[model samples]
Target: MFFFERAIAKQIKNGGGPYFRYIDDLFIVINWPVRHLLKQIERLNNFDENIKLKANIGSFTNFLHLYTENRDGTLFTAVYQKPSYEPYYLPSNSIPPLHMKKNIPFIMLLRTIRYCSTFQTYLSERENLRMASLLNKYPNKIIEQQFNNVLLKFNIDQPLTINNYNKYRQNVLDSPYKEPTGIDYDKVLFIHFTYCSSMEMFPLKFHTLWSKSFGESPINEITPVLRIRNVKNLQRRLTH
Candidate 1:
């Protein structure tokens, strides 16, 4: 996940101009200035490495891998996707590699939610209806309330059941086919995709949403790729 962020950031920094890459799948707005896009491609080509982006764009696969190859000599590789299966493909060269830190499970959950949003339009109406039911059944406000109530009760970040579990349980029991309530899954997806794409232009807004959603000082952890220095950087690059 971090690798995808880094790669997209790298693209924008080098004039790749912001795109999403998940495993072999890639998504880009493709409305950037041609010169900027070209310069990014040129910069990538000049490197002793070849960067390839791929994605299935459907099925929402078990996981995704971000693959890279350095043509100069050895390869620099990173796996952004968590493994869902084994027999993990071994590199032929038997090259031991440096490891990248994985984000916490909650962070992963946030990302998965955001990623799912990108394809909201692509989802079948039935699927969306099902998701809507799920969200309506377990709305974000409810989820946040549940999380907070539990947090306060336990005085720790460790997982715990919400005080209203029985109520939620009863609701579920009463309407087994009904989806969760109060969750704006559609809105969440729309907001996340728009924010990520425009973060370079709206640092303040992006960070604001990030902070609110993740419950932390956004700047401290939300490092935009290209190593965005500050809001000024985002403003300058976006307008330029």
Candidate 2:
């Protein structure tokens, strides 16, 4: 596929246009008739038997989850969602830890900030996220707190203006996220136990016990990763 894309890109370059390819997705721009571009794409399609290319020619299109349009010599971008997409997330009222519940809204709010080109669009997406969170039994306070945190992260304040949004969006695009180095298993300990509603504070209690037992020892340097396992009920016990 790499070689095929390179060959097709070479062909596209001969016609003097900008072409970009990302994991089987292509974005091509040319100052020629649409029919001419289509013919060129068709020729490229014939270059390989396994790779069949389809062209989407339009002034506005969704590419890589972004709805972009060329409007009056300017480009406008917004987050795009397919018609079949549903807003479903982990229920805040579930048995997960409080941090995980808070993370649901925090991550979504960050995504909304990343993908929305304007503040107005981001506000609309935030409202949608709030509604979805409510449907999932999430507290409204958590959603609002996360939203405010995102605004603070981006240095956005009340009476938001397009200039602020444009600056924030540009800053985000210029500095794409780099995935942080994952946990060091060598420096961690895994502790697992059966989970119950009453054991919600087990982690904190365990930490306190550890500090009293080994606070001065080298073992204290190792992080303890606590995990919970759901205990099976009578129905599942019989089935298993």
Candidate 3:
């Protein structure tokens, strides 16, 4: 992937438009004629037989899980879910640590805030999450509390408007403080754990073991971040 990207970087850069690449997905913002854009895409596709590219061009496009639309020269974005997306979340009745289960709502609410660029978009996504929570058997009051928690964390006291959304959205990214100054660490490791309904105690056990092994290390500190999976339905493949 690296070599192929390096080989085509110049062609893409010189093609005369702003382009961004995340892994194999490419997003290009162009104001040229459609004919010229197609020609450039064809040229990119022919760069390497092994490295084929699929291009979609329009005023609206889905990139990096956000639906971005250009309306009268202004850009609007909202969270995008594929057609096959399922609304499954960690079951509220699952046998997990109480805190983990309680955090489900907050984690999801944060995502809604982060992805929905407009106030209306945020409300729409929040409604969808509320419905999904109902299907998952989560209590309505719990969901409401979670919503309030997210609003408080973002310092949103009034009704969410486009201006407030933009302000607090940037604040979420800026809220985390930088690592304490003057602390030196030889190595840093970011460990991620996936949650499974069947293995409720796995994360707790893993953390306990990890602490016993590395708690006395010379590292200044260890921070744990819990990430909730956006996609809950797992597709299984059979191998012969």
TM-score of each: 0.19, 0.75, 0.64
State each model's CA lDDT, in order. Answer: 0.39, 0.79, 0.74
Residues 30-129, candidate 2, lDDT per residue (tens digit)? Answer: 6667798789778878977877777777678786767888788887777788888898888776666777778889888777777787788887987898
What's the number of clashes in each of the models? 20, 0, 0
Whichever of 1 and 3 has more lDDT, that candidate is 3
What ordering of candidates by lDDT runs from best to worst? 2, 3, 1
149-200 per-residue lDDT for model 1 (tens digits): 4335334444323454334323323443456667444344322332222343
True lDDT of residue 216, candidate 3: 89
Write the candidate numbers in order of decreasing TM-score. 2, 3, 1
Task: Supply the global lDDT for candidate 1.
Answer: 0.39
Instruction: Give candidate 2's whole-model lDDT.
Output: 0.79
Candidate 3 lDDT by residue in tens digits, 59-156:
78897778888899997888899888899988787644557666888988788777777788888998998999889988999899888888897677
Off by over 4 Å in 1: 1-46, 50-105, 118-240
Give the 10-residue window scoring lowest on summed lDDT in candidate 3. 231-240
Candidate 1, RMSD to the unseen true structure: 21.6
Better of 2 and 3 by TM-score: 2
Give the top-scoring candidate (TM-score): 2
